[model samples]
Target: MNRVVRAAATVILLAILVPLLVLSSAAVGPAPRHWSGVSLSGWELPLVDARPRQEPGTVRAPHLDAVTDRLIARGDGGWQAVVPLHDGSVYVETTRLDPSLFAELGRDFGGDRVSVVYAPLAPQVSPDGGGGVPAQTLWQRTDPLVTWATLMFGFPWQLGAALLLTAVAYVVAARARRRRAAGTAAVPAG
Candidate 1:
């Protein structure tokens, strides 16, 4: 390939590969095993609770050994519960629900019940939760093919590519040696 062409290709490849590997690595991990459910309650601050439409609620998990209470904040689309764990506090967001289900929860349950799933073994993204968990575990999110490819290849396409390049180089060197020997033999031992 031309020098400029090769460099451009390399840059483009790096751009795509870097993001893909990052996202894939981030995605690769087993989901949390334990989940806790809490109910949202009215806040003590009158202004906080009575923000017209914004009803800031507090979720208390007295049942959970790890957490006693959490201040659930109202987000744009959902609620974020800042639950304190053994390590630190984690912001758990409520998963999206059906429109009817949401409305029913709002009407009947006052949209109090919120399910927060978490992995005890895995690290959390919260600033207080130290850091995120490494993507070492094979049992991860869906897309078996992608996971398999990522495992087989490697980050930035290094490992498998190195092996392939080595094999190709060896083959080329062997062919050159054979050609040199054949030429020597044709010269009648001169």
Candidate 2:
């Protein structure tokens, strides 16, 4: 391929991928409610189960284990490390947990407990709240930049590194092709 063509293709590919990388990173980060949010700490709840939280009406795909599936799902992701609290179980979003920690939660799902520092993103009153009183609600990890950083290293970095390595490979292949062509041209021919 021509050098000009390859360079143009690389530029075009980057234009498409950079935005995708940014959008995806933001999508997987803490929900907007977690931005500048406060969290309740020193709370420990017995773990019930850990699984991907399927939104209503989403296509049902084959279920894979928790961590790898979430890593692949990226932006379209949700996880629940269910724990009993407030006289009922709350779907604690495990999106913020490190992959190792998330996997541990899954491993310990039914038989162990999890200590969490969480914030409720929204509260829905239990129907049995006795006259419209609010009940404990969905829990989310507090949105600190540091916690969000862990998620950044996942999809964005993986994609970025892959793109960069591809570019380097292209450059090496192009150079090797040029050297081979130059060598053939210098040889005596009948």
Candidate 3:
């Protein structure tokens, strides 16, 4: 078989195997879990309870527990919960963020409530907690496949890439050394 053909076949085989291995490894370990998105508007925020009875409601910054009161800034970046309170409703609004949390807001629910959007809350806060929770907030469900793929293939891919680079470097170095030795041998010995 030609060298190119062998290399191509190997690459194709690994490409298929890599994901399979990652998924298998992930399945064996405890899965990484992600929560749904939180609804917030300036000073007000809303949340959904996933227990049997289901607890949902809108909470404001001043009214929420300082320790558990957390919220995400809207404009850029991601959905980050800065601080989680011991037990209470807290909300935070952001302008610039690092990681995106839009999908999170769309997933993770326990009961009748699949998820809650800004059902009542507009960009601005309202006297009735429109921009926040409605005192009947309910969280939704998350995609387990995505959660697994993130941890499984993500770290493995990083490590695999690093190993591949190191292997290439060794090959190049060996070829260089061989060429240098051949050139030296071609010259007359001093």
Candidate 4:
């Protein structure tokens, strides 16, 4: 499309996507308190099953081997992972807690109403990753925001990157046009 068309489309699309951005960001980041981390150094002992300080809903998703996978699947359903990070910390990350479990907290869809449960698996460190924390996922909470962001805003943010690039292109074109006009005005017909 032409410059004006592309620019107009960019504005319209971004406007439509604003709320979506808020949602997905909420999904992956901090909106949900579902992700719980423990001090890896302090709990130096071997761990058994997930020792959840908090309890999640009965319905839960399966555990993925990696954080990235867990994050991607979080919104569809709750999940748990014990990531032993390189920083000597065992990050027990879990998501998609059933809101019903914490009804007193708020409604299932309410911003403050979700929960994730987790506990350290002893001997948290994988035998091989010697020095660094093995990146274990103890537990995580589901924030409406994270859930929304993951489910909604995620795709927009991905598109946002492309939209941003187009915007830059428009700006560059505008500048180039201005320079060309200025050059024309300065040149007396040779």
Whole-model lDDT, model 4: 0.38
Global Cα lDDT for candidate 2:
0.39
What TM-score does structure 4 among the candidates reach? 0.27
At residue 6, candidate 1 shows an lDDT of: 53
Reference-based TM-score of each model: 0.24, 0.28, 0.25, 0.27
Can you write out model 3's per-residue Cα lDDT over 1-190, one digit (the tens) per residue? 6768856865655555544443333334321121223322222134532111113443333433322222322332112233222233332332221113423333322212221211222133323334553332222122334423432344444337545755686599779989999999999977
**Least lDDT summed over 10 consecutive residues: which range in candidate 1?**
32-41
Per-residue accuracy of model 2 over 1-190 as CA lDDT, tens digit each: 6779978987666655643453343345432111112111122235422222434444422222443344334431223333333322223443343444434433543212222222223223222333544332233333334334433343345456658876798889989999999999999998
- Candidate ranking (TM-score, best to worst): 2, 4, 3, 1
lDDT of residue 115 for candidate 3: 17
Off by over 4 Å in 2: 1-4, 16-51, 54-155
Q: Count the backbone clashes (under 3 Å) in each candidate.
A: 0, 0, 38, 39
What is candidate 4's lDDT per residue for 116-172, written digit by digit as tens?
332223223322233533343444234544434333333334456556766787789
Off by over 4 Å in 4: 1-4, 8-76, 91-170, 185-190
C-alpha lDDT score of every prediction, in listed order: 0.34, 0.39, 0.35, 0.38
RMSD of each: 18.4, 14.5, 14.9, 14.5
Clashing residue pairs for model 2: none
Quantify how close model 2 is to the true structure by its C-alpha RMSD in Å: 14.5
Best-fitting candidate, measured by TM-score?
2
Screening candidate 1 with a backbone cut-off below 3 angstroms (N, C-alpha, C), the clashing residue pairs are none
